[model samples]
Each structure stands twice: as C-alpha cells, then as structure tokens.
Target: MNKKILFVDDEENVLSSFKRNLRREFSITTAPGGHEGLEIIKNQGPFAVVVSDMQMPKMKGSEFLAEVKKISPDSSRILLTGYANIENAIDAVNHGSIFRFLTKPCSNEALISALHEAIRQNQLLTGEKELLEKTLKNSINVLTEILGMVNPAAFGRANRVKRYVNQIARLLKLNNIWKLDMAAMLSQIGFVTLPNHILEKVYHQEELSAKERNMLAEHPEIGAQLIKQIPRLEDVSQIIRNQNTDFSEHQKISTPLAPVQKFIVLSSQILKVVLGFDEMIFRGISKPSAMSILKRDKSKYNPKVVDLLEHVQISEKERMQKTLALAQLKSNMLTNQNIISLQGKMLVAKDTELTDPLIQRLKSYDVSVGVQQPIKIFV
Candidate 1:
C-alpha cells in the first residue's frame, strides 16, 4: 500500500499547490488549520508522515508538532517555514520532535527526498518494535512448553499455583503485577537441570539415593547461573534462585538480591505445595493415603506449604468424586482411571488400557492428558 502523508497549512494557495505537486507520489490529505489537522489525525490515524507550516493563525508549528508527537508518535513530523524563521524551525526540530525543518519555497527534489527518508525511518522503528515483542513472547512460551515435558502431572498444579500467587500478590498489595507474571514463568527454569531418573523417582515417591536427591536439589542454582546472562530473563532467573527458600524470614535472612529478585522469592514459595499435590496425583497416590503420609512422623515440608497442599488435595477429591459420581462411571472404570495423550492433545478417560511400550513411547515426547491443562481453583 502507498504511504499516507498529511499536510497542514492555513494558506489556501500553499495547500492547493503542495497537494497538486505531491498527490501522485503519496496518498495525500490536506487540512486548513491546526484544529482541522488534529481532527483529521483522530479520524484517520497512523499516517506515515505529517508536514505542517511553521506559522499559523492559532498554533505555531512547534506547538502543533509537539501535540502530534503525543497523538501519533509513529508518524514522522516535518516543519515548513520562511528563511527568517530559521531559529523557530530549529527549536521545533529539536524540542518539538519534528523529523525535519524545511525553508519555505522548497525545491521539488529536496521536498520529495526528505519525505521518502522520513517514511523509511518510520517503517524501521515500527518493524523493530514488532520484532522485539515477538521474541519476548516466544521465549516465555518456551518456558511453559518445557515445563509440560518435565512433569506432565503438574500442568494443572502450576496454573493453580500461579493463581494463588496472584492472590498472595493482591494480599501483599504490591504494585507492578508484571513482576509476578515474570516470576511465575521463570521460577521452574532450574527443573531442566534435574536428571530424568530423579525427576521420575520424585514424581513416583520412590526413595532417591542421597546423591540423587542432592543432584535434584541443585537445579535451582544451576538454572539461576545459566539464566543470569539473559538481560530480560534476569528477573526470572532471580526467582529460580530462591524457589527452594522457606517463607518465614527467607527474604530478610538472605541478603536481598534486587527488587525484581523479590518476585522470585515469592513465586518460589508459592510453587511448593502445588507441585507436591500434582506429583502425588500423577503417581496414582490416593488422597487419604497421601494425607496419612503427610501426617506420618516428621515431614520435610514447610508447615504452611504442607497445610495448604493437603487442603487442596482433599478439596479436589471431594469435588471430583461428586462430579464423576454424577456421571455414573462404572466401578471398575473408576478404580483404574487412565489418561491418554497423543502429541500435546489430552484425553481423560476411565480405565483405558494400553501396553507398557505404548506408554513409554508417548512419554518420550512428554505426552499426557494431564500436562497441557492445569488445575486452578478448588472447584
């Protein structure tokens, strides 16, 4: 599409002559005054270039261009003035944010060349902004997709954890909710460093050798050190660093990292209970059985995190039993409920049987019904 240019001047002959000269090269629009130009700007936005005469009845070119700077920043601005008004034109160019200043009676060659360059600059800025945004979005998505592979069972748990963290943030009444989102996405980055054997053993509640457990525990430091180099990912990395810290005085006892690092601390504390609940369910552990284990002897979990996790597990069981019972599932099916995942798609079922080889094959891509969708609220 041809680039659009808006020209503003109060003089009838000047507007008519400029439009006649530039009409064929650009999709041109002319306005008689500053107010009319602003109205045109509101009606047809995002023009590539805007050129205004320096002297006008109500507004000077600098003031008009300054206003344009706010209203349509992407549109390149230019000033046109008599040679005697060179000082004013210079101020407009510097402070008024005009792209170029031209003396009145500009030759056709000079005017056309300036307009082309100004439009090219506008296109470059817009393109750069779009590319940066796309890259950021893609990086964040990679964080989530990787999580799905590491633990298919925790997909629902992580979502629920984020919601609770959001609530806690609201409870804390902190400004800058964006930090919360960044922390939530990045807190699990360290899990990538965990050995798959330890990850599976942890999920299945298998007793890990001391060495294996220690290796698993080191993911936070490994992930943090690995991600610290990323400029935008630093906030996420900080959260990963503190994910294993206890809630009580973890923030105070440890020398605080950065303000952005606090999000990491908060997010780390949030994920523990949710991850616990998810790992138990995915391993086919029963609610009463899980609750009994939590109550047995001395548990390693923080008291608050444990209480919250147990509450969530009990509440989920009560809700699911009621919902599934209403559906009238057969007893045998309910006893051996199975989930099938093909690629990234989820299929929840009751007692669907498959060979051990098939399960292993699907697990290779980290496929499972429980991975893509995460549970959030209790209900």
Candidate 2:
C-alpha cells in the first residue's frame, strides 16, 4: 500500500490545493484543523508523516503536532508555517516532535523529497524493531538447546526448581514470568567452567573445602557476566545475578523485576532438592527414604518454598493438568516429538524405538500414548 500522509490546515482551500498537488505521491488524507487531524489519526493511524499548519484558528499547529506525537509516535511530524515564530519553531522541534519545518508555498519537489526521507526513517525504525525481536527469540532458543545438551542433569534440576519458583511467584502475584523462566533455565551456565567432578560431588551433597565452596559461589556472577553481553538476555542476566542473594539480606528493590528472575532464584533451591533426590533415586534408594532426605535439608531452602514443593509433589492432578496444557494435546490425541512444550515433554512416534532416557521418562510418567504424526527429537 502507498504510504499514508495526514495533512492538516485551517483553510479547506489550502488542504485541497496540497492534495491536488501531492495526491499522486502518496495515499493522502486531509483534515480542516488540529482537532479534526487528531480524530483522523485516532481512526486511521500509522501515517508516515503528519504535516500541519503552524498558525491555525482554534488549536495552533505546534500543540496539534505534540498531541499527534503522543498518539502516533512513529509518524514523522512536519510544520508548515508562512513566517517562522522562532520560539514556536523551537518548541515544535523539541517538544512537538517535529521532523521538518517547511515554509508556505513549498515546491512539490522539496515537499516530496522531505516526505520520502521521513518515510525512509520510519521504515528503518520498524525494521530495526522487528530484527531485534527475531534475534532475541533465536538467541533464547539456541541458548536453551545448548543448556539442555551440555548438561542433562543441570537441565533436569532447573525444570524442577522452576516449578517451585513459579509457585512462589503465583503466591506473591509477580508479573515477570518469562524472565524468571529463562533465568532458571540457564542459571548454571557459568558452571561450564568448572570440572564435571566437582559438579557431580555437588549433586551428591558431598562435603566441599573452603576453596570449593568459593568456586560454587562464583557461578552466579560468572553466569550473569556471560549473558550480559546479549541484549535480549539482559533480564535473564539480572535474574542470575540476584538468584543466590541470602533472603535475610533481601532489600526493597525499585527496578521492575520480570517473572523470570524469581523462577531462576526459586529453581536454585529446587535444584538442590532434585539433585539430592536424583542421587538417591538413581542409587536405588527407596522413595520414603528420599523424602526423609529432603526433609533433612529444610534449612537449606526457604521454608515457604519447601512447603510449596511438598504441595506440588503431592498434587498429581495439578501435574497432569500442567503437562496436558503445556503439551497442548487433544483429550485422546498424541503429541508428536516436534510439538514438545516449553515445559519439556518427551514424545515418541510409535514407528520409532524409544531411546533409553526417553523410554524411562515415558514409563515413569505412564503417559497415555495414541497414534499421531511422527516427529524425531534428537535431544
């Protein structure tokens, strides 16, 4: 579609004249005065440029343009004045969001050129906004994939912790869900520098020396710095930075916190539990003994967070609901491997043999599988 331009003038004759001259260049729309221009903008917005007369009857052009800036910020603003009032011109430029000022009786060539430039600027800003969104989404996906593949144990711990964290957020009524989820997922990215032996020890709740304890403390700051370089991951980086702060030292914070930060922080506690439980469960310990082991470490986690997990662990109904909602499955439908949810569910096509980990997960959950489209999931 041709670019839309809204031109406002007090005189009908002036409006008609401008349209007659420039109608071929753009899809032109005209209004008799400032109020009419605002009405037109509200009804059909997103004009490439809004050109208004500086001295109108009821509303002066500067005031009108300022209001237009509030309503449609992306639209380039231009002022049409017969004689420049220096103060009004300055206000138009600074406060009114003016892009260009044109004298009355401007040549068609000059007017066209200015409008074209305004249009180009608008397109550039739009393109930049879209490119940022695409880049952010791609980066998050790549990082999540790498995190899962690099350390399955860590990934599993993060997911469990996210559940506990989300429970806290819901109780507290926090709004930054996505940020919290991301921070929780990659909360351990900094640990990539550590030896696997130390990580395994941590998972088993082994005693650590002073130096080893110091090394573990460094992971949050290390991970935060690693992610801070990526613009879109800025919020997640902050979450990593804050996740390990002692609750006794928690302070009144002013910056807007996204949901993801809490998710990450809460997940850290949950990771401790899951790893401990996993060590036991993997070693063929009884389920009752594993629960007793978790009980022993009550002091290691926030009491409220631990209580929430106990509730979460017992609520199989809630788990099934959450899993079904996340999987986006029909009541009797099977999810293809490709349709895995953000919460992470494993799906296997009946034609393919299930891998060891995938098969273990399926049987553990005792999922109801029905025939569906095939999707190969490598990780």
Clashes of 1: 3
Worst 10 residues of 2 by lDDT: 314-323
Where does model 2 exceed 4 Å of error? Answer: 33-39, 57-59, 147-229, 232-379
Candidate with top lDDT is 2
lDDT, model 2, position 38: 96
lDDT of 2: 0.64
* Cα lDDT computed for each candidate against the true fold: 0.63, 0.64
lDDT of 2 by residue, 1-379 (tens): 3289999998888889889998877889999999999999988887988999898999999999999987787788899887657567777898876889888778888999999998887787667866886787667656654554455455555544554455555655554455665676667677776777777677567898888989988988998899899887776786677666643333234576554544555544544444455446445676567666667655554555444444434122232222233233322232222333234532332112123444444443445543232333222
> Residue 202 CA error for candidate 2 (Å)?
17
TM-score to native of every candidate shown: 0.46, 0.45
